[model samples]
Target: MVNKPVLPLSPIPKKWEKPLRGTVKINFDAAVSKTKTGFGVIARDSEGFVIGGGYGFKNEEMTGDWAKLYAFEESLKIARLLNITKVTFETDCAKHQ
Candidate 1:
């Protein structure tokens, strides 16, 4: 067997961004496994402080893409419930077709 050159590993640091003044940022994500789909949501203020957070589970199985879309919908519902008018929605899924 021939020896192969190893690549160096570098870590990239990620930071949470603050929303605009007087606005809240709502971030959401979803995960789909063999059995079910789960999602999480978080609301942050302009200072990057988390004001509210939520997690949900779906018993019915669905495709990963659908799950992501559903999670986004749920996040919006939560925001409405919270009476958050000015919000910046963030999601890992592609919003447009």
Candidate 2:
């Protein structure tokens, strides 16, 4: 097997943060259930415009590693639509990692 060089990703430029003023944060969580899977997203500005952003699906396809990857990819796509760059991503499956 040939070894391939792995290049690290450069950090997103700070310029992306210019449009955002004050402090803002968003949280994402996912709960996997047999009958249904649920994920929630909450966005809040320092001023407190708490937004309820979440979705739930009742299907077995919404479980396991592939499901998890899909969830993150979808979230990333949504984030790209907005001009938000600074984000905190937390996952409870840290140990399994």
Give TM per candidate.
0.77, 0.47
Task: Pick the TM-score winner.
Answer: 1
**Candidate 2, superposed: residue stretches over 4 Å from native:** 1-23, 61-70, 91-97
| Model 2: lDDT to the true structure | 0.51
Give the per-residue lDDT of model 1 (tens digit) for 1-97.
Answer: 9854432245355566888999999998888788889999999989888888799898878887888888889889888888999999987523323
Question: Lowest lDDT 10-mer window, candidate 1?
Answer: 4-13
lDDT of 2 by residue, 4-74 (tens): 44433453332212114564455555666676666655555545575334554546545555556655655
RMSD values for the candidates in order, in angstroms, are: 6.1, 9.6
Pairs that clash in candidate 1 = none
